[model samples]
Target: MIHLTLIIVDFLTGLLAAGAWALASAGGAIAAVVGSGILGVSLFRRWRRRD
Candidate 1:
């Protein structure tokens, strides 16, 4: 019974860790996309001003 409980706890911990990792990954991806978009727009505006 103790072993089974330990196993369940370990499994739950792993699931939580995986979920946290996925959330961090998604957040990083969104940040990258938004950063790039802002950079692109800024560059575009600069180029247009130069022209």
Candidate 2:
């Protein structure tokens, strides 16, 4: 019983670690996309005005 419990705990810990990493990466990607969009829009407006 103790062995089974240890295995389960390890499995859960690993899953939690993986989930955390994925979440962080996803958040970073989303932030980058949003930042790029904002930058693109601003640049477009600036160029339009110059033209």
lDDT of candidate 1 over 1-51, digit per residue (tens): 999999999999999999999999999999999999999999999999998
Q: Which stretches of candidate 1 lie over 4 Å from their true place?
A: none
Predicted candidate 1, C-alpha RMSD: 0.5
Candidate 2's C-alpha lDDT?
A: 1.00
**Least lDDT summed over 10 consecutive residues: which range in candidate 1?**
42-51
What tens digits encode model 2's per-residue C-alpha lDDT throughout 1-51?
999999999999999999999999999999999999999999999999998
Candidate 2: lDDT of 16? 100
What would the TM-scores of all predictions be? 0.96, 0.86
Query: What local distance difference test score does each model get?
Result: 1.00, 1.00
Each candidate's number of clashing pairs is 0, 0
After TM-score superposition, the amount by which residue 28's alpha carbon in candidate 2 deviates from its true location, in angstroms, is: 1.0
